[model samples]
Target: MSVPATPMERSVPRDARTSTARMLMICAWLSLAIVVVLSLSIGATGITLAALPDAIQHWLAGSDDDATAARHSLVLLEIRLPRTLLGLFVGAALAVAGAMMQGLFRNPLADPGLIGVSSGAALAAVATIALGNEFAAPWIGTFGPYALPISAFFGGVITTWMLVAVAGRHGQLMIGTLLLAGIAIGALAGAMSGLIAYVSDDRELRDLTLWTLGSLSGASWPKVIAVTPFAILIAFAIPRLIRGLNGFLLGEAEAFHLGINVEATKKFVVVTTAACVGAAVAVAGVIGFIGIVVPHFVRLIAGPDHRIVLPASALVGGTLMVFADILARMLVRPAELPIGIVMAAIGAPVFLHLVLKRGIGGVE
Candidate 1:
């Protein structure tokens, strides 16, 4: 009884752009939720999603006196849950940081690592892990778990500001200039980290290696609590940069004429990106490419609108990281692979393809 002429109607769409972005964003959030659940369920000691509810119920009710309940609680609450939470937060931070960096420089290749922020932060953390025990005991004791994060945060903020100062001219940041400066600074930070590694004892070397390679194996509730603020900052505060970031898609002159605070925007982005990257490094070591990969992928699906790009990047970034962490665990069985290696395996090739196809200039 249906009309045969409905082929034309099916081909026509109304405001598909809005609908598409909305759907993408929805799917992104759903993907994050599903990934988090799966992350909890798939480790060496498995906890299936179907079993999660009863586990939570017994855990909450404190009726978990039985050995099986105790085992589930130990696995879920003590080990898997913290890492899963850490992965979620760190992933979101890295992704948002990458998106913000790209938008700030108006170059798709602009990443947190490129700016020397991650290297500088990692250097600080490595120094703390390698030598702070002997030299800075008082401060470390006072700050406790916060000492490393605080040092890394300061290091990141300082490095990022130095880059901004060097690259910013009359409120305009030239992409090429910043990229060159970032390379120089990042190399210097890497050298310092290497020096620290050279002087480190076997124990210190092990710690440094893990920090650089990146892992959630060290995930603990305190570390989760440590990173929560930066995570919230990324999740909520960074979206405010969308308007200014959009303005920068045009020239800085154009953005200024449009009443955007070009200088302040540059500073805001550099500082926030530095802090976010620093916190992430302190918690998970040098996990790379989340920022670059997630945002670019989001842009492909959602167009270049910073508004859609930022939040979507955060969601997708978190989800992608969860999956990566899962793979890192499973790839080596009882032994875990570093998260950085997983990310590099994926990101390095994507970066190479972009360079080959788009060339360096086309990234802008």
Candidate 2:
């Protein structure tokens, strides 16, 4: 026979858990800072942190009078900084997106790719690569570097809209229908993307291959700027959904009774998640597992509270990406491995461990 817990016993654990969660939140932010610095410092060119200050000062001085300093500064300002920032943004967006999806679906294993968003983005990106010279020329001319990302973003958006349309009944979103529809649509999108890749010329095929594997080699100031708004959009929207998300953990009916607009919250989550994942995929290609792994790790340290889980996931996600990018650059030295490959190698093992130890419903 089991003994019942006293109120004091329960209250003490709650206080201790809250304290531990807060401490982990701070630790997450600090880890992000450390990784950002490391990302800016360690690379093929090997810009030491000690020289980073001097490099920045020279880069801002607007004169290449000192050839050595100019080279270091150029590498620092032009290459590493933008790449670091992109990692942070993409990491945060993808991880937070995973957190939101997990909360919405009430499943610890959920990810944005479950709903065809990544597939749609990939299909559109691949299509642009194959057909850019003919069909996408006008878009290329008009948008310049923005064209591919823009296409991918819209592809994700259209996929989400379709998911909503197919899964909604009487103004209520059915989770069972959504999951089934997502799997079917996602498979279709993947098939189409494969078909496009199969017929592409050598150059386009190479580009498609590199992109589908994912890389930050194309990181630039414009790409960073493009993804910033979406990152900010996710950040701004998270606080409003915190209560609803926490209530959602108790089931949709309980959330509705707590005065949460269950339907509205569902719509908001799907929209924001799509936009976040879309923009991340747009700039960085199809980097995976940051979404799934980061949130689960955060929950392990910080507990399952969305208040801590969401923001902490963003911080930890960005940190993980920056670190992964570092390894990608250093592992092969000059030739650079794709960031996605590094992520998969690292994330797959961790995810497997989590599953074995905690099981699927272990977020609590």
> What is the TM-score of each predicted model, taking all chains together?
0.88, 0.94
Off by over 4 Å in 2: 1-10, 361-364
Candidate 2 lDDT by residue in tens digits, 1-364? 8766877776987889888988988898898889988888888876677777788788788787888888888788888999999999989999999999999999887889888898899888998889987987988899887889999999899999999999999999998788789888999999999999888989998889878878888999989988888988987988988998999999999999999999999999999999998898899889889888999988887688999888888889889998999999999999999999999999999989988887743655
Q: How would you encode candidate 1's per-residue C-alpha lDDT over 63-106 as one tens digit per residue?
A: 74677776777678877889888898889899999988888778
Query: All models: lDDT?
Result: 0.84, 0.88
Clashes of each: 0, 0
- Candidate 1 global CA lDDT score: 0.84
Off by over 4 Å in 1: 1-14, 164-179, 350-364
What TM-score, to 2 decimals, does candidate 1 have?
0.88
Query: Which 10 consecutive residues of model 2 have the lowest summed lDDT?
Result: 355-364
RMSD of each: 5.2, 3.0
